[model samples]
Target: MPAAVPLADNAVRHADGQGHAARFDAQSTCAVIVTHGPDPALLQQVVASVVPQVGHVVVFDNGSGGVDVAGLLAGHRRVSVMPSALNVGLGAALNRACERARELGFLHVLMMDQDSVLAEGMVHTLGAALVELQQGGDVAAVGPQFRDARSGELAPFVRFGFPFNRKLRGGPGQRVSCDFLITSGSLVPVESLVRIGPMDEALFIDNIDMDWCFRAKRAGLSLHGICDAQMAHSIGEQLLASRVKQDGVIVHKPFRLYFIMRNRVLLYRRGYTPRVWIAQDVPRLVLKFIGNALFLPARWQRLVFMCKGLRDGVAGRSGGLPG
Candidate 1:
């Protein structure tokens, strides 16, 4: 593999070898996971699922206090974790991990969310699909079909289509192209990251994947979701468990609401994001606002945060919300 730009710094890599690095070939893929205050038991399950599937694994401990990450998953020879003293936002944490993956000479990086647990052969399925898709040289990344761990829902892939956004039942490596994919369970070539750039740290949390995917499309690259490759993962938002008429509107906590609304506005202003998405998202936001206001927990507080996010986003503000 050719050299990639510098990526990691200040992450403490424990265990797994001699103070040196080895360069790997295109066949090598490293799983780079970002974790911050994750449940130890859940994190262990996530680590166990990934370790057997990849060439190497790097976990970034983004300021989770008092967690002995290494000890929790001790005796795993292929795993190495980087601990941080303070929390870096998801994008920045991933940037370091991807950089470290490159530094370790891996040709590909698998970005895994801390909560996502892979099914058996999921990595192989995704790897095979990626190898086949990238043969044409226009592929950006390949993600998996995920079953929502919370609701047992089989999520659909989406494409930007005329009249409305089209939900895909199939993905790239087939005839259709996916508009965007969630960051977790996605296999990205190291080279593509170099070309498309890293996640937008300005987003902090929400819409990071959308921002990256949109940028990739503007670069003339295509993303795919492999139907056979699957994972059990929970999305950030929860569907109302009661009689709330959500009507597909998702609600987050008040704090998360701020980032969702703010980063959404940020993405809306970016030239690289497709006009179709911009058109589609506005109504969704309206619905989300209404749903959240009417039935979401702490509705008033969430609304205040959301409106503040909108104001700040329009004012070109970025990063985490103020206290």
Candidate 2:
């Protein structure tokens, strides 16, 4: 395992003080937003949206553009900033934040992406849903329905039921029990973290959320999607289009293709089972490789990524995102 690094010097200072000021209460939840490189304006908007409701807001900057994120958040009485000088990838950064949250006595952690904005009362809505789930005594984590910021339409939250073979889609305003995988807009209880542990930093960037969910399920925790709470996520059109177009293309950009292929196989090896892998993962990967080869600009890199992903998955290598 790579040596565990603290976020950034400034982040540590900010969090250290604020951690003492806003200790967690059982009645309140703390939110942690993870960012790599986010537009300053967008980050501010995200802070403004959640600061009022959550007990505290911690911004985990993963090797951002050296912007003064700590300065930006300094004024807010409830906000603290943590920066990672090296881009340690999202999973590791979040785990660090979760660890901090635990130390601060927070009972729940809300994971947010820097570009996302919660809908009006969305935090309260998710909080309510989580309370309901806890009362029911079965759910491990719960995520809200996500809406596309650009399109203004609800995006389906995909759920895979037991036997892990079939995927069920839950539309907007429809509640569904799931083996919770999606994380961009979700709230997780600290208890779940204590039980299943933080996301696998080994898987690093891709499918880390799903990998966590699968582990939680195996440990006898249930995951669910709460339909009422919603957030608008900026899934940039250009990146989306490229990803869809190159689903199977053997393109160049080895780093991009490498994680896509590697994480898929890693998920399977971890516990996804062969039937599930064949029915879902394989077809998606093959087509992705083909799509990249046919349409993407970096065909050779893409193919190399696919090959490496296959090799790592088969070899059962685990720990951190590929460098």
Candidate 3:
């Protein structure tokens, strides 16, 4: 056989030192859900829900607060646990998992967050949409509708439009051609991932998915929403909040405000044009900074984060948020 081509510069080589061929046949698919020291019950529920639908489950553990996730998954025949010694940020951890999944020969990899629970038949729904896209011949990635767990209502997937400051909202059950923003419950094709390369690890946590989706779009792949498939997510739970109910219960968490203010500017500078930044984003960011400074505690930290994001953007730094 002819020598295999390297999928990426950092791609692992087979025993003979050439890149290995992909493992999955045309019909088979693999799903990987990333977790970091999540509640064991939630992990079990996530695994139980997903294992039945996919060919295999690879649980990417990013330093789970000393949780024995591997032990929990030990007896399962189809589940494999890969542990990281420390928290390497979401983008890096997911990229590492994608590499392993690619090597295992899975055609499609579903990138899932720990707090989100897959609704019944969610996997099949996404998979069917992917197949439809593939048959249509131009689809690159597919993401499902994300619903708030408490209210049972759909949430908006943030779409950062050009000219930086403007964002177009994608509603639940709406099928649209997106400009590189998908939420936690998204499915990525292994071939496209290899072609586009791993996500920017420097992003560490926020906006990494959007950055990757943008890159995929730039690489000529189409991104779509599978309107039927839905995943219930506990939004703002990781950050502490006093809960209140609207359409669903709203958690008023302070950390989310900080991250949002800091990362939104960073994303615009790195992914969008400067004109967009100056026209749309800067004023909004300034208003946010002022509001946070006046009302939120740890005002200095929020301001510092905003300044750092601006500086980084001006310096042409794209991947990773400030440490």
Candidate 4:
């Protein structure tokens, strides 16, 4: 096990004379970042992008490989580091981080990833939209449209459908309602999370955003995507080019493939998960299984892991990958 790192440097503001207002504006939100084995340069860039935007920045290092998080973020006064000796998985880290933010009087949290860098005023835009949207009804969470920094490809928010899942690419300044939003670059109300309940820690990494969104939807809450608020996020390890109308594929590492396959089965069994999603996603998962096996390097190993994931998922297994 790695040594336990301190939860906070002098940067963390302890609850004291400080008071929190009942309603939160853009700058009052705290940012929760969960990390494991993050690239130092990318991590540094991620921190730089967020520090100036939020009230507090809390980084939960999920047993990183001696990444020197403190050194990388030394000069930032409002940032804190909560390092764990074990990789506690994204769901657990997010719960702990948000709890910390709540204790520090932040009304909302901007969920972030180490690889994603927010564009200027992105958090403010999401927060602003959330505040406005909630005036009409219960707003669970709001997120921004994230684009691949490498390719100029913009990602569209998704809604479950019968023959096709709806891809939303609303015009600028439009707030599009979606079934689920990715965790990164999302601005969520800490209170709404408290109501929706903590994230499903058992599944660990993948599909956390989906589970939470499903739960929120079940509870009669809504999720919105602010089309103008943008984030430069990297999905997968690389975007390889292929002639099939350009692969445009997001290729992840082999280990993540196991989690993706496993989590798919796990979420399918959940009551709150929309049945329509399970119905629609079946083909995608099948294609994913076949595509990864055929095109990716280490095809045999990925296939073996994917099979194990299926077996374990059916057996109701959860948490980290077993040795």
> What lDDT, from 0 to 1, does candidate 1 have?
0.79
- The residue-level lDDT of candidate 2 at 220 comes to 81
| Top candidate by lDDT | 4
Candidate 2 residues 1-323, lDDT tens each? Answer: 11222223112211222122122232356788898767888888888988776677777888877677877777676677777788887788899988777666666788888888887777777766666555556456778777667555565555543334444446555667875546766778776787788888877777778778777877887777777877777553233324443321123344756666777777776544334434665776787778776666667766777788778878877555466
Candidate 1: regions farther than 4 A off: 1-27, 171-176, 241-249
1-323 in candidate 1: lDDT tens per residue? 12322223222222213321122232377899998878888998998888877777888888888887767766675778888888878999899999889887776789999899998888887877776666665678888888878777678888876556777766434534688899999989787899899988878888999999998989998998898888998876675455543223354678888888888888888887888888878887887778777877788998898899888889889987677
Alpha-carbon TM-score of each model against the true structure? 0.87, 0.81, 0.75, 0.91
Please, what is the whole-model Cα lDDT of each candidate in the order they appear? 0.79, 0.68, 0.64, 0.83
- In candidate 1, position 106 carries an lDDT of 72
Across 118-181, the per-residue lDDT of candidate 3 in tens digits comes to 8888877776666656654555677777767665566654445555422333554556556554
Q: Top TM-score: which candidate number?
A: 4
Tens digits of per-residue lDDT for model 4 on 5-98? 2324323322222232224455567888998889988888898999888777888988887787766777776788888889989999999998
By TM-score, the candidates rank as: 4, 1, 2, 3
Pairwise TM-score winner, candidates 1 and 2: 1
| Candidate 2: C-alpha lDDT | 0.68
Candidate 1: residue 140 lDDT (0-100):
82
